[model samples]
Target: MKLHVIVPLCVLFTLTLTQQTPSRDKCVCELTHSEKAFPHDRLSTVEDDASKCNGNITPQKTVELENLLLGLEKRLPQLQQDVSVLEREDDGQLSSVLSLLVVENELLEIKQLINRLNITMLGYQRLTTNTTKELVDLTAEMQELETYDTMQVVKRQNDNRRLRRDLDHCRNGHQPTTQPTEPPHGNCPHGQFQNISGPRVYTAGEYPGSYKYGAWGRDPKPGAGKKSWYWIVFLTSSNKFSNYVRLYSSLSSLIVGVSTPGNVLIHSSNPTTNTVQGPNVVLYGDALYYNCYNRDAVCRFDLSSKAVTTLQLPKGTRFNSKGNFCHLDECYLFTDLDLATDESGVWVIYTTTQDFGNLVLSKVEEPLTLGQTWRTSVYKQGVTNTFMACGVLYATRYVNKVTEEIFYSFDTTTGVEKFNLGISINKMSPNIYALNYSPVDQMLHAYCDSYMVSYKVLFS
Candidate 1:
């Protein structure tokens, strides 16, 4: 009986062991922890519950996991939308980069164009500079040539005049005088101006260079007991204006400081209105003619009556230092209106805006009327002084400190202009501020830097 019971017990024990053993060696849930895991069968409800209880998770952890799953579920569509937007932005970014590259290429082209323009401008500027220098040189050369041509013409004219004079003398059966003969008194029977002698008389008078601007000469028309009288008008007010004119019975009296009795006063006050304005003062026929102060007009101060008369100039006349006589070195201030006397009558030499700073001459008639006006082509500023003789206007220019050339002439009788008259004047001083021709003595009276100089006029 013992052996049978032992054998039965052993068999039961083996059966029990076989029943407790699993079907597979490992479970699907166990393999799920690895990356190589595969899905197989679902866990039973009781096992799922037991596995969750064995996971050591609390109630808070379960709620958190549920919220995480719900949040992921809600954000899945937004994530997909973000991916689409990023894909679109990639294409837009590529297009923007292409545009930037195009802009950079255009900028490089513009920079090259600007550099080319700068080079072109520099070339033009250099060309202009060279051209300007060449033009200046050519102008100077042309002026020199013109001067030479003028000298030739003047020499021919002199020869022709001399021949004419000799022929006349031969026809009249009289020997031609070796020297030119002086014309009769109050008669201009001689021919055109041929030459001018050097200053026959030069003296500073009583002033002795005390005044830089003034006019001194014998009057073309004198009253009784004033035939040999010489008058001087000193610009004592800042060397620009004057009011009194002093008279001397003779040039010797003027040199000896002998004051004559008829010292005319233009105005009692110095430099007042209607007083003498400039150094170009002229004493003609017992009257003083000068530029009216601060006006484009002429003022005539009568000595006998102590009366004043004014004659307005033409429209657009340049005065008050606007149209001054100028040379290469300097200009004479307030020489705009030049009052000159010839054998005919008193005349005015001025410039008008319509004539472009050229000379405009007009005859000043009796009773202060503007007579016939003559326009000249010569520039006023180029002349140093002008005078009238035999109804012809002669203009002088600066040559040297000791010489002045009379190179231009305008004939009112024939309306002819001659630019080749090369008569020269020898100067004791540098500048001649006031130059006037006297029909009475047939001389050129020049007020040159405070010196009164007279030149003998030689006619053919």
Candidate 2:
């Protein structure tokens, strides 16, 4: 085909240089392998070639290709049935829900197709087959999807509409703002979330000076007729254990020490097994959930009955291992699993054997039972910490010894991902292993280098 479009000399020169690069050899090999496998009934041994060409491709790109090939290989047999269903759609053979699912399935396929195209284009000049028409078609399809935020906008819009309707009803049911009184001590509320004004992440120097230091604790939720109360853990006077509990009454006139009845035992079912761990703790109902030290398990300590329940994590889960939870060489102490509490219940974020080192968020349904909540295939090797607030999952990355930022968020309700949080947390200590967000007081509590600090969350 004769080209009629004008091209800048510099652009052409750069393109030529990129094409002549040695990386194109691996791309060409992959493309040729893909073509041979597409026509053959036997599965392609592309993994072998991909392994040999590892240094030539980015790790992310390699993962994308692996997942795409696996999915495509598995779904190839369903393509004919899908086509039949598409044909029968004109005759109304498919239900609305099924049809919507079909659309989603196709969108997923298109997304993988785009990834393949990206790989193919990396070796543009080396391509033996004419891919101009395919490129044009895929580009057009992507443009159509991007106009509406690639299916994410649809879900977000639907969520906003539902929330707006609920808000309208709530406004109609709005009551006078009366200060709620504190319920009697030891009367813990059921598993629930506090009503918050909005979500926020306070930057350094922006947090109010009201929150005190010298304590590491679970994020407090509104309960027991009180708007905010924290379960602060402290070491006993003997320095042999950290099983003492203190309450930080946000509403009380006094902001000093207030001891509670129950003391948390830092041992497992066997009295000899010490389960003392740090940073992450969740308050749900009358039970406090935290990961057991050196054990791949979450421990639920009951305040009323003084009973302990241990929920074991999946096999291959990291725990108490050196260099397990570190983003870089600067490692934090004893961070294996992160426990968080939202409006509804408690959740634990940890890696599983099935997720290939990716983060999995599972809901704590019972004291010992964990319900699978959500899983993202994106690897969290760069994540320094994770916490849940208002059903949304936020992750932080270590920028330096002095700074960290909330670099990622996943909205469980809408399944949306955000990457543009510029909010920064200034740390006095080089190691900050623990982070939790309190909905009732709208604060992010952090345990940094043995010092406890609270940052006020300011909503935009």
Query: Could you say which candidate leads in lDDT?
Result: 1
Candidate 1 per-residue C-alpha lDDT over 1-460 given as tens digits, one digit per residue, 9 for 90 to 100: 9999999999999999999997887655544432332222222433454454444333323332333333334334434544455555556677656555544543443344345445645665675576566556555654544454533776688789999999987887765545532212223455757788766666666667799998877788899978878888989988889998899755544544546564778888877889988888788888999999888999999988989999999989988899999999999888889998877778999998999999999999998999999999999999999988888889999999889988888878778788877778988778999988887878898888888778888886
lDDT of 2 by residue, 356-421 (tens): 777778888864697867886546566788877667777788888777876666767667666656
Model 1 C-alpha RMSD vs. true structure (Å) is 48.7
Q: Backbone collision count in every prediction? A: 0, 1
| RMSD of candidates 1 onward, in order | 48.7, 30.7
TM-score of every candidate relative to the true structure:
0.59, 0.48
lDDT over C-alpha atoms for residue 444 of model 1? 90
TM-score of 1: 0.59
C-alpha displacement of 359 in model 2, angstroms? Answer: 1.3
Clashes of 2: 1
Task: Please list the C-alpha lDDT of all candidates, in the order they appear.
Answer: 0.76, 0.55
lDDT of 1 at 359: 96
